[model samples]
Target chain A: MDHIEHLEHTESPANMKKQIWNTFYVLLVLTVVDIALYFALLSSHSIYKNILFVFLGLVKAFYIVSVFMHMKFERKFLASIIILPMLFICFLIWLALTEAGYTFDSRLF
Target chain B: MSNTATLSTDNKQTWGGGKSPLSISYGKLMMWVFLLSDAFTFSSLLVAYGFVRFTFTTSLPNAIVKPFSHLSHTFTEEMQKAGLFVTERWPSPELVFNHFPFLHGIHLPLMFVSLMTFILIFSSVTMVLAVEAGHRMAKKEVEKYMLWTIIGGAAFLGCQAWEWTNLITEGASLQNNPFGPTAFAALFFIVTGFHGTHVLSGVILNIVIYINVINGTYEKRGHYEMVEKVGLYWHFVDLVWVFVFTFFYLI
Candidate 1:
């Protein structure tokens, strides 16, 4: 009976559906923006173009993990446990790019 | 040594027990750890793709032929006449992935892929809905959302199959391609094939869970943790696709 009461007291299904639709709309808008930027920056050699793409991609990724995966509602310690390894991934990216740069230089020179 | 021994004794009292340090269940914690390790595997693959692509592009020769030249013989001739084929270092992804469903022969660059991305993301939303329904112990709602989620997974897999078929039929293989560099075809196949395999497995897993939902397995267990666990995997797959789209196609 207490569990039944708790269910009734919690957020309604309509409210949950609203939140889901909001997230879907946000993701759809981001994707449209991403595709537009892809074409807009197609011929440009600017470094900022790549930076913007990565930044937007990360934002989308964060939303999916946090909301869709419910990581945002998880305990802080659990969130950290899942997210901390990303630092090591960043280190891997840095190392790989640096090595690639060196390889390119050597091949060219 | 004596000081370290004393610290070890103190640590045992506070942290050495078998309790879950993060206050999550053992199953969920294990899943997170598995996903973390899986993330590393994907990161390494994408990093390798970056390294190969950078090296290939920087070292490309002048006057590279357009990709899929054989299929575009007339266009290639016109481009050759216009001296357009004399430009470009590596094959651009926009040109490579331009084919759309049933719009064959039209240059619809990124349209099909964007549609695929939308489907995957929408399916992810359904997955979260399923999890939400599970939390409320709404079995009917859970079943409905889970069915939608399963259909989404299957559809994504079907799209991937179509994409792969087009790639192969258009002359891209692990070893060779009409594309600029051999490594281009190789990395494309490896990274996307790995992801396709994941989606296939995810679809199968979703079907299993959907069946179990219909069987009242979770109701018998008195909780819907299974839905939440599978949701983590599904969301992880979508997360990886976001990175794959950005790194492989957009940039």
Candidate 2:
């Protein structure tokens, strides 16, 4: 029993507090930018505007996952193991939207 | 038999049976796995929303309405008459979710949801702070931050309830939508409702953990890993909101 150690976890960095606050500011600014862009491109219903918004959302997600969730400090194998599978969502989006376009074309209205 | 004895000596290696390969505890690793699967569930819902939304024409440009202007009592009616809200077109989120609490008819767009986003983000920060405090074994700091996190979560839930009530009063529900196509209201309810349910559970979890902290359970156990585990869950909720805001509101 003495030889068996407690469950292991990665150590927090010394400046973790500062890093947390910095990430907060980054997330805050990115969200503000998202709102600003929403207004700035209000009249343009182009696909590019939607892409830009999604891109910014990904940026915010990165900060949250990397800093707030501590994925950046974790082992690369673990991070990749968790994140790589999410790429399939990109495939799903493309397939669904393409089918949706065909559905849109077929509609009589 | 000799091979078995020799192989046992390699237990400290990457494939070692006695050690975690990822250097993460079983509980934390499972938490990450759960979050990944949860992410997929949310992605599927949002993708369905995108497919349905894509089938409809993009929202018609709005030249008549401006932010902060007077919102007429018949605002939806006016939009319907103006053809801004029609069955063939997807409704712009700004027009649909424009109302704010206690400031009726002011024509605020995306203001309340933005505040909701801010609340969730702020609470996420507090949760991480609590985890940070936990690392230091600072019980008081952990308790304080956990309380703040709980308050933020509760406030966010309150805001969602108000928004839901507002939409319901305006005749938006799963089966009916006065704004535009029925699917618009349906997706809104489903996506945000799902995320709201997650937040509700998160707050409940936070409260439970808060009690355990108050009881000095972690102190007695000689570690605060539980805080870190629940913090992972709290942050995942916030992460889902980021995409929910993007697709449901912004895009």
Candidate 3:
């Protein structure tokens, strides 16, 4: 019973509720911004507009992971174990988009 | 001095047997790792979307149709006639996903998806709140929040079903898309379909957890870590939606 009780991990701050709502508002605002930017930049069709949208998405992602996911309070070692591996996704995006541009060019001209 | 040496021993003991060095429960840690692997799966799908999307030319500018403008019954046909929907270029998501339930012939571009995003995000918030309540051993609070989370999840699924129906009615499928490219419809269905399946499962899991909460399972066990674990999965579903919204509708 002692060992089983030890397996129960509970570590949350008192103001966690406040933090949750704040993060909710932040996500809400960021999503509204996402839509606003989409329409504002509709006619441009520039790569920078896409990057801007992606950047906003990443901001929203950070808040969700850090607050709602309770990652901010987790141990550094645990956080790294879960987050560090995702760096490969960045590399994959870069590689894929780079190749895609070449494919587009080859097919076009 | 010897105090430093004792501290080193204490640190070593943390890594030694009889303790969890990471300070997380075995099940919760497993949940995190599972979410990480799941994140990778979603990332691969979204990245593939980006790759395929980047290969296609951008959609032509639509200066003719403004938001809130009255749409005709032959909207897709008119767009195709106007060269807005073609095989050689990608179609703007705004034009493709403009229909909302019961508001036909209205050019409300990304509004429905934005509502979907809000639904998923609000559900995620409720889920975390349930986890927070579980920490306090507030059984009633946990039950209420879990129910809300389930409702949010269900509402999101309904919204998706409606959107999917509208698209299918507009003649979108795996092999055929009246929109710009067939691949667009295919990828849209696959990515959002995959994410929708996750939401469905999350709702099911939330229902299970809600039942357990009502039955006082966690209260009897003296911990709500199960809620926390499921909370992580629910949040992950929301996280994937953020990207899906970015790649599919916003981009």
lDDT of 1 by residue, B1-251 (tens): 33234334775632444443344566777889999999999999999988876664422222344323333535434433544332224566776687777776566668888999999998999998998888888999999989998899888888988998988886779987665567777888899899988888888888899999999999989878899888889989999999999988887
lDDT of 3 by residue, B1-251 (tens): 33234335788755655667677888989999999999999999998999889889999999789899998989999999999999999999999989888887899999899899999999999899999899889999999999999999999999999999999988999999999889999999999999999999999999999999999998999989899999999999999999999989988
Backbone collision count in every prediction? 0, 0, 0
Residue pairs with colliding backbones in model 3 are none
DockQ for model 1?
Answer: 0.36
The true-structure Cα RMSD of candidate 3 reads 2.7
Model 3 residue runs over 4 Å out of place are A1-10, B1-10
lDDT at position B46, candidate 1: 94
**Backbone clash pairs in model 3 (N, Cα, C under 3 Å; residues 3+ apart or in different chains), count:** 0
Candidate 2 clash total?
A: 0
True contacts kept of each: 0.62, 0.80, 0.80
For model 1, residues A30-109, the per-residue Cα lDDT tens digits are 99999999877676756688789999999998888777776765656678988987899889888888898888778678
What is residue A70's positional error in candidate 2, in angstroms?
0.9
Tens-digit lDDT string for candidate 2 (B1-251): 33234335754565656656677888999999999999999999999999999998888889999999999899989999999999888999999999999997799999999999999999999999999999999999999999999999999999999999999999999999999999999999999999999999999999999999999999999888899999999999999999999998998
TM-score of chain A of each: 0.83, 0.90, 0.89
- DockQ, per model, reads 0.36, 0.63, 0.65
Q: Global lDDT of each model?
A: 0.77, 0.92, 0.90
Candidate 1 whole-model C-alpha lDDT, 0 to 1:
0.77
Error of 3 at B159 (Å): 0.4
